[model samples]
Target: MRRRARELAMRALFAHTQGGVDLEEALRHALEEMGGEDDPYGDPLDEEGVAFARRLLFGYKAHQEEVDRVLKETVEGWDFGQMSKTDLTVLRLAAYEMLHEPTPFAPLIEVAVKIAKRYGGEHSGAFVNGVLGRLFRRIQEGEVKAAPKED
Candidate 1:
């Protein structure tokens, strides 16, 4: 359920950032598409899953500036413009969760890697894993602080 929520949040983030869609609209569309008849593997999120997805989406939006800043500083070699959108979106979602959610870092990173591998370029899983691993270390070392919880 959490993994599905993360995937939906990533898709909604991509739609909002890259496609210039309104955030709420993007989320609604993502939810609809996920449950739409065309998606063979689509299992619509349960209510709890939907709430989690909303938390991720709004939480990320609430802290996008800080999230992007952290990502810009943490990512090695590739600039934001050079990274795959899917990979970047996955990173952003994971980063946001790292900064706010109480979930353990290992599973968060694992889920992000899986999502990247499923929806991203050839090396996206590795790229996301490496970057997120570094970010997690920074958090552990107190270089990054968790953002205040959103209302």
Candidate 2:
């Protein structure tokens, strides 16, 4: 159920981002569509899981410039500007979790790959996996901070 909600959120975010709508407004719209004051998932998600997705969404929005810079720099020869809006947004969201969230790298990477496969290009899973694998290693090695201080 939570996964479904996440997918919905991702899809909405992707649409808004690609269409150049305001991100915070888009998120607020997502929250409202999902039942602003209600438990929209039906099943109760653990606080950790709910928080994980929310943090990923907020962090992605908050640090979009930096995130895109990393994407631009790390993708080497891959033009993110030319990618599908859906693919780019999914990549950004998963990259946010992979780099910024307090979860383990492996699980985050796996989830990202799955999302790419489910919603992106035929080879998007591998593409996302490769990018995130290298990025995760850099973070683990202290070459980069997953994200700036979450203040």
What are the models' TM-scores?
Answer: 0.93, 0.73
lDDT of 2 by residue, 35-117 (tens): 33453444544556456556677788887888887777667557976776666777787677656666666665676777778
Q: In candidate 1, what are the lDDT values of residues 1-151, reduced to their tens digit? A: 9999998999899999999999999999999888678777687799999899999999999999999999999998989999999999999999999998877888989999999999998999999999999998898888999654434
Worst 10 residues of 2 by lDDT: 35-44
| Each candidate structure's count of clashing pairs | 0, 0
Task: Give residue 67's lDDT in candidate 2 (0 to 100).
Answer: 82
How far residue 41's Cα lies from its native spot in candidate 1, in Å, is: 2.5
User: Model 2 segments beyond 4 Å from truth?
Assistant: 28-52, 147-151
Among these predictions, the greatest TM-score belongs to: 1
Q: lDDT at 13 for candidate 1? A: 93
Residue pairs in candidate 2 whose N, alpha carbon or C atoms collide under 3 angstroms: none
